[model samples]
Target: MEAVEEVAAPQVRQCPECGTEVTVHVRYVSWCAACDWNVDPGAPDPDRGRLAQVRRRLARRYGEQLAEEVARGGSAAGRVGADRSTVLAFGLALLVHGVTAGLFLAAAVLIIGGWHTGIQPVLGGLLLVAVAVLLPRPGRLPQGAPLLYRADAPGLFGLVDEVGAAVGTAGVHAVVVDASANAGVRTYGFRGRRVMFLGLGLWEILTPQERVALLGHELGHFANGDVRSSFVTHGALRTLGAWHSFLVPASRGNLMDWLLNTLLFLPRWAVYGLIHVLDGLTMRASQRAEYLADAGAARAGSAGAAVALLDRLLISEGVEAHLRRESVTAARAGGGSGGREAREAAERELWERLAARIGSVPESEYERLRRVSARRGHSVDDTHPPTHLRRRCLASADPRPARVVCDGPRARSIAAELAPARAALARQVIRDHAG
Candidate 1:
């Protein structure tokens, strides 16, 4: 008998019947052990096997094209990971608290000195009152105008409808927020369904497919019930941070401020330290959450496209930078009919600039910093895994290590079928309801 060909270890053979890729080091045979399909050179697993072969062939070709695009200056953008809005809000609140506390401390010092510091107390009280009134109101989001309700845009209403249909669930509404470089879904009210929030700039930066992936990821959070947990965690952090924001400024002085200059400098590091701890927990959850979302996007359809888009976004300098560079590069690249190509050129230019600006770090210096950062294992109070980790997570074939969902070609098919419908619904939700 002719020797049965064996695919190398780890790299599994693509399934002929289901188009699912698999690996087996057990034994070489004339047919697939899992599906009982022919493996003989002349008699592959019938028509299904043939189809599988075709899919792989096409995927390989597409992969090559994508690689070329990347080589020729097609780079992905980065998501804005920092919660700038929250940080600013916290900062302002802290300033108010610190100023008020200082005033009180000064007045008490004067009283002790028998100088009758009555004005200080009045000023302190008024400042405290003003902060109390303003703190509860919405401060700002990272992007967009203000609110992200779907009723804001009419043209994209059809997109939302499709997403609802795919999940076979309701109590979900979509909105567009003027937040910075982030997009996500949330749930509010007693019912606790998914409340989707899309960033205004996200779509402008992402291709339609990538946008779908992002939406799917958010929806996945709802599907996986991570949204509730995340909200709970976020709420707790917010509450604690707020408390620190208020009290730290108050605590900056011991009895000394009363005895001396009465200066109550805000404890910036102390508050930030607490935040970093909270952010660490949030970051761990976030990494897992991203995987789930990626899966959701896969389920919605277009897994390859979704992954491809992610690769694109994550590799770029970032969305904000892209926006800053867009106009200048567009004018320079001028009159190109190919949008994708033009965009690629712009991104390539941007990266080259950034790389140049970053300049050449000495090999030894780069190594030292890399080691130090790794040892530190994430920054204080940032809810994100390292960028490298994120790239690996998104690139993973089986995202859920615990509960293994389908993967390889089978997984791709399932994702491809559902992605379009889901994407359409998402668009609609944002357009019709973001008012």
Candidate 2:
């Protein structure tokens, strides 16, 4: 089996655009020694749902506008202060909470009336159900979620705390590990405590300093006054999203079901509209939060490391693709009965294979990804601005020394702590992705 074809090149061809002799790396469409061609593999996930489509459209719209403004101006990290959206978001949140309170009150009144009149308290029960449906989902760790506490991973937690201090933010309350090629932070629990999620896939690929930068970025994400991260408005958004999801049917059903669905169409659409409006109202502010986080990354990890971290993000898709290919290869190697053994073998070598693939990314490929990033609306996700823009913001900023350092010994200690997780994640990727 070929090990990540993009990592190794043995083919050379003339450029279709310039007729210049070029080495054709399987990573991208084609490469020319003298000219750029259609290197852009636009929008990786195209077949998204209607709601997702709306979110992506809005993301690109806002991201492009912001990127354009930044290109003309100096930095993308412009401070957003007391923006209209923040006020509106807070008001909307209050309104949502008010509605919930009213429903509960109505339920109470009906229940009392039923007790006096000896009536069936059906309406009260129904109102209570509605209140339950509309309640906000507090961020909680999913059952069986992989956890890395300070006790189990003190060095990692210490590094994160240092980065948090450097970025001028409070330390996280919890750390969760997953297999995704991304990292993020969010508030959890009743008191809105914070948790930092680190994806081992991304973590393994990053340099020690880059990890510090990632932590800095995540730690600073909400501290820079992102209203979306505010637990108050967060409840509103979550409740509305839940309402929409609960009302919207995945498909049409039987006659009576269809009739009820038709009756609910307007209410369902209203909830959806609210969700969209909420997203639109806060998207620019959310993106601003991201740029601010990038600024904090530079502050905590040094400008160079922060910029390199963004550059590393450009190739994350490639890493995912490599995983998919490796999984398929592993599954197929066993054919029928031997698939399990083959997958186990693949699992054992997963980290090494991934490390080599990431290490082998050519400079030209990074440039291509960067260019593609610039051409597309700057976004790694709906809320994130583009990788190119983030990179530019970091690179163009005034240089600064790292506020926290991850020396060799500490790096080794952190790695040792993550060993079990890494091993489990390797099996997870193969098991989940193999076809």
Report the Cα lDDT for candidate 2. 0.79
Candidate 2 runs further than 4 Å off: 1-12, 26-28, 41-61, 64-80, 249-259, 328-345
**Residues 396-434, candidate 2, lDDT per residue (tens digit)?**
767999999998999999989988888888878887898
- Candidate 1 CA-lDDT value: 0.43
Task: Find the candidate with the highest TM-score and give its number.
Answer: 2
TM-scores of all candidate predictions against the true structure: 0.42, 0.87
Residue-level lDDT tens digits of model 1 in 295-365: 56655545564565444443232445534544454444444567556544443343233333223222322
The ten-residue window of minimal lDDT in model 1 covers 73-82
lDDT of 2 at 19: 80
